[model samples]
Target: MMYAAGLAGVAVTMLLILIRVLLGPTVYDRILGINLFGTKTVLVIALLAFLGGRTDYLDLALTYALINFIGTVAVLKFMQYGDLGWAGDVEDDSDV
Candidate 1:
């Protein structure tokens, strides 16, 4: 019973995040919402695994987490530089 309630709460939170993603005024806001949604998805998968007594879901959740992090970083990098490759023309001061 408690597990069900917790899952329901997480579901509700995801729904709220979805709404924010749709209605967010800025690109950054939407991106942040997406990142949050991904985190919640991992939690949901973990919770489901625990409730079902299956350990395989944990593997899936970990894979998803890695993918989510890479995807988020890629999106943010693309948003900032308009491409995935680092701009060679830009000088790095840290190397100096």
Candidate 2:
């Protein structure tokens, strides 16, 4: 009963986040919305696992959370550097 209410609340919040991701005024705003959505997804998975008495789902949720974190970091890095494999500034000495 209470779990169902919590799930409903999370679903509403996720819907709002999805809207922000789609209509965000800036790229950063969209990125933040995506991150928040991922967090809510993890919460939903956790709640479902608890409600179903399936602890194995918690492991899947953890894995998804990790992937979500890594993906967000990768996207942010690409946005900042324009490339995922960007290396820091390197001094050129071969001309000497």
| The best candidate in terms of lDDT | 2
Please list the residue runs of candidate 2 whose C-alpha ends up more than 4 Å from where it truly belongs after superposition. Answer: 89-96
lDDT (tens digit, per residue) of candidate 2 on 26-85: 999999999999999999998888888897999988988899998889988898788989
Q: TM-score for model 1?
A: 0.86
Prediction 2 global C-alpha lDDT: 0.89
Model 1 residue runs over 4 Å out of place are 87-96
- lDDT values for all models: 0.88, 0.89
Q: Give the TM-score of candidate 2.
A: 0.86
lDDT of 1 by residue, 26-66 (tens): 98889999999999999899889988989799998898888
Weakest lDDT window of 10 consecutive positions for candidate 2: 87-96
**Residue 31, model 1, lDDT:** 91
